[model samples]
Target chain A: MKNIIIASTSTIHGGEYLEYLLPELSKHFKNCKTILFIPYARPSGITHEEYTAKASLAFAKINIAVKGIHEFENATSAIENAEGIFTGGGSTFVLVNELYRNNIMTVLSQTIKKGTPYLGTSAGSVICGLSMQNTNDMPIVYPPSFQTTGVIPFNINAHYLDPDTQSKHMGETRETRIKEFHAYNTIPVLGLREGSWLDVKGSKILLKGNLSARLFRQNQVAEEIESETDVSYIK
Target chain B: MKNIIIASTSTIHGGEYLEYLLPELSKHFKNCKTILFIPYARPSGITHEEYTAKASLAFAKINIAVKGIHEFENATSAIENAEGIFTGGGSTFVLVNELYRNNIMTVLSQTIKKGTPYLGTSAGSVICGLSMQNTNDMPIVYPPSFQTTGVIPFNINAHYLDPDTQSKHMGETRETRIKEFHAYNTIPVLGLREGSWLDVKGSKILLKGNLSARLFRQNQVAEEIESETDVSYIK
Candidate 1:
């Protein structure tokens, strides 16, 4: 069975919550050899060695081999050869750009379709969505926006801080940003507050988080949602 | 028949496109009085008198009366009394913030629903969508994201410039930003270049602009479209 874990962070990195993810992730890859994907770490300008070293600390207790995408020229071979793939979070745009540029986006999409275990966090989590409309990043800095690999129908607003504090700094509020998102198109948006995630196994989607995810339909109020609720939020 | 004109700008006394809009605006309120809604002009920090004075110049030859939303205590009253409403664009987030905070979003929705000649420019045009996810502005600010009047189902990336100037400043390319948008959402984004307007009368949506609009769907290539081609782009 293909197990996909789209999370906000790895090992409470950056003070994010990871309590809800450890158990679930451990259960899915119990005996599998894990390969960590670190595309989102590009913004730190950290070399692959440094990036993977920080990530290894998160999975230190788990007895699994962890390798970064940079170790191999062809990411497809690494992803295909591994029992599971864990994508760490950083700048989703940057990650997606590299994936597209390296032609790994297509490879990853095909790998996930083949039932390979996929684990994503933050920017990694967003890559699982249809688009990144809900991201809290500067639009001027382009990341790969087009080909998300269709892991999920709607865009995931990763690291989504609710009751936004930046409203005074700029103009518009979080709700307004999502509304503007709706004005352009009809795809539903999942505002994933930090610590939240969606786990996809086979065809079933399981929500794992402390808070209820906010859902926005075109020209409608954003609805609060609890985890483990079955929903067809697309369109 | 209620007539509405949504535009990117109004003459700040004199600009290249003042003549084109002034005559049409005058005709929209030929027999009835006119009220120009200057919601997006909040950034100018100009007094209402100054703002109104600038708009009046556009109607100088036509001898038509013009006023801003401040002229009335309630925007609903101003909108109700006017035969036509011209929404001038400036900062989309600012306009949306005021509309959402003052609880005039519904009134605007009602006005548009009643076919009460609703005209919007730039940011104003953005308000017509289900949401503003496609806008070129930052998404950190919160306007009432869920409060757009739903003038249309798709979002508009207004003032959609080529990857010339902004690309140089930001590390990620324009195509990368747009592609990231597609990665996170399934909604079709319309990259409306300047001098473009979508005239909606009943069920028909007519695209009016000097250049072709760019349409993007999830996992699909961005396609350039001809104006007046009735395409079902929002998937």
Candidate 2:
């Protein structure tokens, strides 16, 4: 059975318990050979050696032999051989670009179909959605602004935040940005707050987090959903 | 002479002011009828009647016979007949959508060729650029995302607020969003902070604002340009 753990972070990453994620992840692989996807970590300007070192720390406790997909020139072999995939967060755009350039999204998609456990955090979690349109990041740095790996039909607004913090510095509020997104298209957006994880095992989508995820549909007010309920109502 | 005014707001009507902009605008419309385009006011959720009243208030003070393009079924007619155009700000996406739907962008391009004064504010300012790729809004609402009128070759990230405000809110920082935009393409972005405007008259691109605007080219560090002299260095 293929299983996926789409999360915002690893460790006490973004106000959530890493231990909680491990329990669910543990069920997927008896001997997890976790392939750490570090596409988002490029923002730190770290060399390949440094990036690999940092990622290794995150998986030190797990029994799996962790490695980054970048170690190989071709990602096809890297993805196919891995028992499980763990995507760490930094920048969603960067991660999506690497995936697109390597043409590994299709292979990963097929692997997910085979029931290989897929774990995505923050920016990593975003690529597993239909489009990155709902992301809080800038959408126009390239020729094609709306492309994704198509793990899900809905867009995931990762690191999902509210608008109540320092209003003056953050520029526009999240609500305003989402509303602006609504003006262009009617795609559903899942505002997955930090510490939240959407577990997809088989066809079931289980929300595992302390807080409820906010859902925005076309011309509709953002509503909250309970953790245990299936996310079939997103569309 | 064709002239345009892309402003942060209409200073005459409680919108952001362009004290430095009026003189330049006046130079372009020496003997032309100034038409004010108010497409961004749709977000107030007000009836057309109420919105027109607000627009008229600004037009009346300028001692110019100003008409809201929204008053007509074909807004392009207003653009076609007017000697010059001034688009006011409210919402960039809404303004772009209305302009696209009415085919006024094509009209505005022709009007500019006739030396019509084309003035835009906020959303209007953004529409003046190559694309709205750098906008600080949400990605879900598309507003015909890639169908910009293409008056300029580069895109503008309007309302270009600084990134220090992230601590106060849960939304992604402005820097992060723009970085995400960079991941998809290599188009240069001019982040126009509040109170700033870019004046492109007969190939002379002037930067008018209290502070410097941030310019990003590819993967390089975003540099700040303080004055017209600094803008000249960009090309």
lDDT string for model 1 (B1-235, tens) is: 3345555444322344356566566665676566655544343234556656766666666777677887788777777776667666545655776787877787887787787777776677777776655554433234545346676666676666566452212223345566665545555667776655566666566676455777866688888888776543463
Q: What is the interface RMSD of candidate 2, in Å?
A: 5.2
The residue-by-residue lDDT of candidate 2 on B1-235, one tens digit each, is 3234444444432333445455665565556555555554354234445655665555544545556676767666777777556666555556665677666667777777576667776666777666766655544433554456556567777777676632533345566666656655666778877666776666556787676888887788888888563253343
Superposed model 2: Cα runs more than 4 Å off: A9-30, A36-53, A70-81, A90-107, A143-153, A165-171, A183-186, A226-230, B1-57, B63-81, B88-114, B141-155, B165-172, B176-188, B200-206, B215-230
Chain A TM-score per model, please list them. Answer: 0.87, 0.87
Native contacts matched by each model = 0.04, 0.50
What is the DockQ for all candidates, taken in turn? 0.05, 0.33
Task: Compose the digit string of candidate 2's lDDT tens values, residues A68-160.
Answer: 787877688878877777776655555665676677777887877687778887767777787776665554433134566666667788777
lDDT of 2: 0.64
Candidate 1 chain A lDDT trough over 10 residues, lowest sum: A164-173
C-alpha RMSD of each candidate structure in angstroms: 14.5, 4.9
Q: What is the C-alpha lDDT of each candidate?
A: 0.63, 0.64
